[model samples]
Target: MSRPAGPAPLLRRILQRGACAALVSGLLLVRQGRRDACSGAAPLNAISHWLWPESALRQCGLSARYTLVGAIIHWGASCFWSAIYEGHRQAGAPPPRARPPSRRPPAPASEVPSHDLVNALALSAIAAWVDLVLVPPRLSPGFERHLSDASLCRVYLAFGIGLAWGGARGRRAHRLPPGTRQLHVES
Candidate 1:
């Protein structure tokens, strides 16, 4: 009997997720910077201000501090989403219903389509849409106030691309030696 392969190593998975989040968020920041710059505005300053208004941070008396705080918030959010996606992958595909008691082999890991890039892209898109349209206004007041629709679209696209790329990279890393099982056990 074959057991489904275990998920990738915890540290590796975390790194992959973190890297994806960083890339996506960094690119989004750059995109926002470019757009704001074209309009003769200081984009970084704008991001810092948007994240924490001057009134709110007035006591702190440091705009740079607010910018750092905003960066942390944005990247933390990206890592959070990446963790969610990785959790789903680790759980593997759901078992089919109503199987008779038998010694049938477990399905091969490759047969499970959950780790594929297309699925990642689809999941990212849905997650982005839901987060942007459904969750923000209810949970995060003024979250969308500083962002335009085009900027949001770019953000989503970057996230999807980053997710797919990270998943593909992790999958490649997790491929076992031809005769090995899971991590080290031999068949």
Candidate 2:
């Protein structure tokens, strides 16, 4: 039998990336909510200084200027990373679940992670480095302005989990029957 094509058609893959980005973006927002609970969503407002860069005070109230802009920025960033993750799969990091079943019984989830999860985490780490380290303070994610480093870690953790979960869900939804299992990924 012919091997199932990895991923999906070009158009579908693009859509999948968008879907993944949405999921990741939603997770990020959820994490942001925790910050909101502590600070009045000011973290969202802090992200953009287009209007009050010089002002010491930034107000966040779910207005178009604050939360909306932050959400959009977060979504776009998610999309960028999702595209890269999908591109890597298309470029031949064996599609997840395409690997042959392990002869030994599948290990507990905690013990083993599919390659896709590792990849997702790596991408997430890269994103954290870029957003927090490489990017200038002016360009840094606004949450940092209001959150402690511990809180930031939680946000990134949410991001990685979202990315992996989204990727896996997207893969399963598009999975075809009797696809080739020739691809071997060391779990």
Candidate 3:
């Protein structure tokens, strides 16, 4: 099936991966927090613990204020990174070939570019650096407060994997299918 060639489809694809990346990374943060922190999801809640600075040091729960705010922040970052990745992929992608679909079935998620993982990982690494080193401590995700350096690396890795897996759900989107893209596209 031919997809409409325009900004609309492109935007949808980026959003799909963004939402997925946010979720995957957030979940891992929660899991790691539970394993290593005083409570569950503290790292996630710590993301927006600015209002309650002590939350990063001692508090750890699913409170709406901390968890909700943190989640939004994470989601926004994921989407932003996904957009950057999509744009880079678009710039480098070869023009579509004239031949019909090959005998081989579509790799799976036709909506997602075939070669994105490396780009996604590289982008995630940059994101991690910006978050940890450039962003002021108060504005940071607060993950480091609750996790070891090793665990922190895992969370970043999860973010990269999440960006890649976001579109892995299916290619039914764009044309509009019920999947991760549904979170980003109006179907």
Candidate 4:
């Protein structure tokens, strides 16, 4: 299947990923707050404190200020990831080539899932792992140190779902119409 010839516009990528990130992060924040309340733990703003330790924010009485800043940072990071996805996608686009018709039988329609969504979700999950597991230790966010394994799992789950949704939306936007020019077409 042929895809569009170039990367999507920067604005489109930003809009897709930024919106998804906002929604995911907002939900996680509310969920975390509720969990903390039920367990009678301190109210924690995980996202802000991850990038800027809660201790430091509280020391300056700037937790609220930095929360907004952290959110901007988070949304920016999401857009960055979206841009990377587009780069990989453009690079992976098949070059034009002559090919023989397939002798093998086509798989039934029911057996085929949308590859774009499958690939997006898979890649998003990988990205989430890198972000939640690998990066935290390297940076050693003080706020993250207090989080239980379950909380971290929830964070990754939310991020993965958001990434998949945004990516699939972007991919659908760029898809070529059926019966559009294929590699076999000649002028």
Candidate 5:
């Protein structure tokens, strides 16, 4: 008789595809929004300044170059945190025993829930939005001419690319035998 495919593997594949889609779509939308915002004269320069206060430190304060650096830094940090969280989940291990006589209990399902890659990607996208739409604006010039929609879109795109890269790495790691299975001791 032919064997049935395991649900776990199927789920993993689905999750991976979802993650890729979310990362791409979220980024594109953010970029488009940024572009639309920057095309006007009373340019949202305040928003740009707010998103990148560090640019204010430059002698020629608020140049595109300096703002770009800030955007890159922001996106980079968001990607780093998402990857770190996903890595932790992927590499987590069950409790271990130190003695031959030890009787360990099986881990509860709640404690060993399957992680969905799509969820991770979605969260990463949310983080990117928070950084660009809320955090930067509140902390910086609050709506400068440079804070054009285009600039914000580029920032989101960078964040999305980072998230996609991390997700790909995580998917590969998930495919490894070590990452796919978990061990637990039972009494």
Candidate 6:
């Protein structure tokens, strides 16, 4: 048996993990919201309630405007983290050993897997559904509330941190061999 070449395996694993993470996160948020509601806590808001689904967004002090703001924050964070990871990988090793001098170079190590675009979009949709469709129906009338702006900002920060951490891990795992000369040979 022989290992396959290129990034097919790596891509598959990333997609699998991304999907699993999104599913697990969604389920946990739903469960927490239900538990909090049952305990008489305020219900979380539709757009800004990832960490504590049971708590009302109103209590957190966020406005409806923060929803769009948070989305923008998330997108920027993802891009930033992805770039950092790719940069790190590029810096880690020598160029691949074998190559046509005129050929284009491979992508940087920190680059997000192309498959991740789909995963990111799917995860975003899942998050929206959890916040909007699922949480609202389960919330009691008294639970509907908005989060504080500060609290929403904090959540965005945490989300950014998570993305950075995941990007770093991916970059570390996918390091291509350094030294272009070492990678290929003229037969």
Provide the overall lDDT of each model, using Cα atoms, as 2-decimal numbers: 0.55, 0.62, 0.77, 0.54, 0.44, 0.40
Instruction: Please give, for residues 127-150, the per-residue lDDT of candidate 2 as tens digits.
Output: 889988998777776667666777
TM-score of each: 0.58, 0.66, 0.79, 0.57, 0.36, 0.30
Q: In model 6, what lDDT does residue 61 have?
A: 31
Candidate order by TM-score, highest to lowest? 3, 2, 1, 4, 5, 6
List the RMSD of every prediction in angstroms. 7.8, 7.3, 4.7, 7.6, 12.8, 13.2
CA displacement after TM-score superposition, residue 127 of candidate 2 (Å) = 0.8
Higher lDDT: candidate 1 or 4?
1
Over 4 Å off, model 5: 1-30, 33-35, 39-64, 87-116, 125-137, 140-165, 169-187
Model 3 residue pairs with clashes: none
Note the residue pairs that clash in candidate 2: none
Best candidate (score: TM-score) = 3
Write down the lDDT that model 5 would get. 0.44
Candidate 5's displacement at residue 179, Å, is 23
Q: Runs in model 1 with CA error above 4 Å?
A: 1-8, 36-63, 93-115, 136-143, 172-187
Query: How do all the candidates rank in terms of lDDT, highest first?
Result: 3, 2, 1, 4, 5, 6
Candidate 6 ranges beyond 4 A from true positions: 1-102, 113-122, 135-172, 178-187
Instruction: Give per-residue CA lDDT, model 1, range 1-187, as digits (tens).
Output: 5334445465567567657855775567556645633321223233344455653223222244654555555566666767777777658858535558558754443342454566557766776677667764433312234456777666666766777667666665546555564535458
For 96-160, candidate 5 gives per-residue lDDT tens digits of 33557437753433231224444454555676565556764555323233445655545445444
Question: For residues 72-168, could you state the per-residue lDDT of candidate 6 as single tens digits?
Answer: 3334333443444334444664865654555666566666565544444444444434444576554322222333334333333333334433544
Over all chains combined, what TM-score does candidate 2 have? Answer: 0.66
* TM-score of candidate 4 to 2 decimals: 0.57
